[model samples]
Target: MHDTIFDQLERDGFAVVEEFLRDAECEELVAAGLELTRHLPDAPPTVFSTTEPEQQQLKDKYFMESNDKISYFYEKDALDADGKLQLDPSISLNKVGHALHLLHPIFRCYTYSERVKALCRELRLLEPAVVQSMYIYKNPGIGGEVVPHQDISYLYTEPIPPIGFWIALQDATIQNGCLWIARGSHKSAVHRRMLRSPEDRNKCIYDRPAPVYPESSFTPVPVSKGTCILIHGNVVHRSAPNRSAASRPAYTFHVVERKGNNYSEDNWLQEGENAPFLNIYTTSQMQ
Candidate 1:
């Protein structure tokens, strides 16, 4: 199983670990997520949210609908729109993220699970420890494409070596925006480009040759709720617009080796390097 996943990742830059969590585990996670969602405030309106005529109109504009429960343990100026990087006062009371960060079995499984450790041994990344995570929820009626991009572009780590585990909380399918990877694309040299301004979000860089793969190039990673997809940090990946009748929820956690480790810096993209604190939201009444 390890070899299969390893080979797939080497060839495709990503692999799906089917049934990584049992059915009961999926149910448990969903329950925990539901409980958490009840207490979280609705997302602050984005540009599209206020301009649209209705909730469905907003969904129509972005081609997607998602309710996010963000845990912001790490804060950096990188995400700051203006010069000031302030803790969002709206989320100051959120402390439950610590529970998800340190104790969740899924988080541990992605970071230090035996299978993952063995894979790390093969990849030779055992020095620095794993250090971060974030969860995502994509509800039905959400439609948007995650444009083609490399994960390293956003994180900016030196060695550019991190792994993202996308665990499904509900069954994922092609109709529901399941992930698609460009085979053998992880070998490309890293590039750091400016974040697209709101007006230029659809732009694509064309400086380098596009990565190559077989004619049967794309692989759709579909799995039952509770399975996971392990992906390389540098892989070229994206997803289709969700057009399914059901909601497709998933949690993605990014893990990296702990700080102060010697690694490749030749192709490093200069960017933020701080460990973010966990951001949590709860709807529970204080006891």
Candidate 2:
């Protein structure tokens, strides 16, 4: 705690906070994350790709309607050639996403825990609203690579950009695909935008070229369990594929300023009237 998280975030576009949560807390979250799929309905398997592939575009209703539900997506390689899972659900699942914070009890409690409130206050996030939550299970041997990109590309806002809180429930290492970020890349413009197609509501389109970084530009950040990585909205970051025998579990979410920012209507995630994004300042869970 020598340098403040805010200072490091401003200087590097990302900050590492070690021991933010204890081992017991991390274990609780990991076990809770494992049960997320039980809340999902019986739908056809949907693959959550870290890389946007034009051939297997995930722009259908299943991906679009997950903003308010606890949804399960499978790892691409975990499925057989016929699109059926080749492994158990626990090992084949890629992530549970979008609404865990607002809908799930355990996730909601942690999302608004005292430590999170203190962190938000310290970062000076006035009128902050939760955008999305993800519990990523980088399953052993089949974990995919997340291509380098800026967060603003998906969660766009005018005037104010979003910030992400990525917490590791398991130890993150080079072998387990720890995050690699381009230092100070937030100073650059957003590399691309994920916009809803004008004609087709079921389609998602990219505006600019996808991010491509040099090998030497990124620095791998390996953190122990219960640590958090605060990422700037415009920072270029990505993770390699986990080919090791271990699993990497992480809980991440984004917060946006609601006061001075206009959330883009064409963004991938749109809040409904009945289930609007929760403001941390007024959420009862904060207490």
Candidate 3:
């Protein structure tokens, strides 16, 4: 692991590594994402969507498919009556997303790569493993804005928090909805989480008030394709909607310590053998 990248993360709560992936690697990753479209109809039932009416409607149907494998969700109008996305995906879909890394070899390569394991070691995360993965299709015009929030707010873990590793498969710009982070916010003590209610389990609620950081502390981060952005668990961040004509596609995964974590049963998503986490590393070896 590069010291510069680790230093930046320690100082700013996040770090941006340019060209972490080569041009050819980026092309291959993008192609893998596009290839997922052809198998959308039969993919696992882990799909989710933004706040668009049409897209939100499909969430229930897809979510009920199968909890053991990968799934694909899209923007409201991306699918027709036959549950198929348009041939020209650029204009028809918002994203083909949710829990794909372990199920797909192409994505697993990056999620469990040696390069990533080294970074996890640098962070001093004990027994680090991937807990979640998603590919965002910030398509033009229809892509929705993600409100400011922290990763630990959703992926609740006690004593240790999850770190996000976001990869830019295509150029990410302010005009096309790149991430904006609250600089140094990770240093602030924000221990609460946004989790489902224990009584209903279906209801979403926060354990405590959300963190309040000064607006002036926020910084817009624009990165080119192949760039990797490392974000601390407590750092507050968000992204605007994609209004530009271009698309901002990205692959993101989160890592958390396996031992000493609560791994609450009430957390919204709980299914499969491993349920919510995937082993990315083993003692004396990286998976």
Candidate 4:
């Protein structure tokens, strides 16, 4: 299993681990998420809009109005009369820095599995560390396409290298905007020019034009409920808009090496500061 996942990630810049979660665990997580949403007072504002420029601008505005921390959780609620909750979505990001310790065992098991460690070896990262995790939901006709970009571009890290595990809470099909990856893209030098905004320009490592990969060389990765797609930090990837009749839900966790080669502190978020959904935890405490 490890070899297969590793090989796929090497050749494609991403791999899918199928059935990573048991049916019981999947149902539990879904229930918990739904329950959390029930407590919200209002629905979350849509984050995606038409036009790359408009989407970029909205994202920039959200970042500025939000805390400096790039990781956090969002909850949207439908309220009843007298300010009671009707329904809601419980979403969060930055799991490692925020709530890994508090996560259900099943969720942690998927991220910390041996297969994941082996993939880290293929990436040349040692003593891997999970940086954060994000939980997101797309209600019917509510989610939009995630622009093509690299994950490392949004994070502040010296080495600018990491791995991502995107777990699907429901069936992720092409119609639901499953993830798309540029095959073998991670092997190239990091691109620095595709960014479309200037608000947090420095936060992005790439400034060059978007590199085009032939469709024949790339593939859309689809996974059933309870599966995950593992991707490299430098990998060029994106997701289509969720067009499925039902809501689409997913989670993403970022991991990196602990004391491995190419370690740098320049881009690391300052300790004790709140980032997105992540609270603060020291390196030692994380272990």
Candidate 5:
């Protein structure tokens, strides 16, 4: 068999590897996710839209730890005009995780699975560390648009950039806002990052003037529930807002270099100089 996925990644900057997870496993994950949403009222402080007023309450609740914790992002319809979060699992939830692998056992099983590690080895990631984990629920009609950007800008490391593993927990179709990527975009250098404002501390800044790309270049990627989309860090990609009647929930995590310890301390999510980024291979949960 040809090295299809890896070959496409090298040339096109992204690849869709089919059947990465079994259908039964996908169903299990979805059910587990639904269970977690029940605790939204007591969820740890979350990082979401700055436009909402509820951010202040979350800031007050978590105090200093608010900035770095498992956050919630609700669907637009889930909130009132005043932006207060409504108390219903069906309408009021969009995403329930940032560090899900660390917070829950089910997610950790998927994150540190041998299948993921072997994929990393195929990509020649020698000492990969799991840096971030997120479960995104692209709710029906209100799933927001993700603007065109590269992953390297958000959480960066010197010498090399991280790779993103996005697994579709539901059938991702064109109607439900499947991911879109600019072919060969990873060949370009990262232009900007959404970083915390050093001065204000509360706000984030997108280094400007923003780098622009042609709109006609993007191609939609639709996959089945168990499919896995492996994304290169420098790749310019985005997804549209879901207007369809169904939801597209995806489990996404990121991995970066660890052996050389080149992960940048200045990255907004880094807690401190000595803070440890969980090692994907040897983490206690993985064991």
Candidate 6:
């Protein structure tokens, strides 16, 4: 079965593993998403933009600290003219990101589950480490558009780049901003990187120009609840704005092969020397 998964990934650049999570597992994650709001940390309102994340999100202190902390970001439409939240925090929240899989118990359990361990072994990742995780709330009617981009451009690794496990907590449909991935596009090299500037580590630097992809190169992948999509690091993908009344919430994390891989120092997400990325094989080494 794992061999089949690898085959599909090799052919398609992305593979959908239906029923990757049980109904109960999906419910728990969704419940945890709601529970997160209770522990809010007086976050100053900031809008999240995938296209210009460096300009919009990097400027905020909360975003810079989110690497090891579960932080909140609001949707642009969730705010009013004066930059105040016009809707409920639950309705306005764009995402709680960068470290839930490491810091939150519920998230940590799933991230280190036997099922995930099996995947690590299949990839021959002797020491698999997860550097980042996110719980994206693609809320109804005004959910934002995520511009086409590659995962390795951000959480990059040398020789063997990380892969993404994007699990859906709710049904993701075309009407609700389901992901649109370019078929077999992983064969292309990553032309740009969203890295930290040398002069200002807090700022971002794009090593090359963003490549333009034609619409015919992509396909919409609508999946039921509890499904998981395995995305290659260089796969070009994006999601349209959610125009329906329902939400398309998903939990995603990237796993880097720690055996013989070099994680770029200039990557926007950098953990201090003492606090390193969590090794999935070494549960006790949680950071």
Give per-model CA RMSD.
10.8, 1.8, 4.2, 6.4, 3.6, 2.1
For model 5, name the residue pairs that clash: 46-71
Please give the range of 10 consecutive residues that has the lowest summed lDDT in model 4.
Answer: 92-101
TM per candidate comes to 0.60, 0.95, 0.81, 0.67, 0.86, 0.94
lDDT tens per residue, model 3, 234-260:
888988888898888888987777877
Provide backbone clash counts, one per model. 16, 0, 1, 16, 1, 0
lDDT (C-alpha) at residue 283 in model 1: 13
lDDT of 2 at 154: 89
Q: What's the best-to-worst order under TM-score?
A: 2, 6, 5, 3, 4, 1
Q: State the lDDT of candidate 2 residue by residue for 9-98, as single tens digits.
A: 888999998899999989998989777655545777888886765724446687888888887888888888998778877778888888
> By lDDT, who's the top model here?
2
Residues 57-102, candidate 5: write the lDDT tens digits.
2233342232345666666666667666654665456676566766
Question: Looking at candidate 6, what is the lDDT of residue 283?
Answer: 78
Q: Cα lDDT of all candidates, in order?
A: 0.51, 0.86, 0.71, 0.55, 0.74, 0.84
The local distance difference test score of model 4 is 0.55
TM-score of 1: 0.60
lDDT tens digits, residue span 1-287, model 4: 35676677777788878887767766766665555444433433323333344333233444332323322332222233443334433432111122332243444454556555555666666566665655566555545666667777644344547678787888888887788888788888666533323455334233454555556655688789988788877788887766568666776777755563343333323223443222122222222
Error of 2 at 93 (Å): 0.9
Q: Between the candidate structures 1 and 4, which one is better when assessed by TM-score?
A: 4
Question: What's the true lDDT of residue 202 in model 2?
Answer: 73
Top TM-score: which candidate number?
Answer: 2
Which segments of model 3 are wrong by more than 4 Å?
1-4, 42-67, 77-90, 207-215, 274-276, 283-287
Which parts of model 2 are misplaced by more than 4 Å? 37-40, 55-58
Model 6 residue-pair collision total:
0
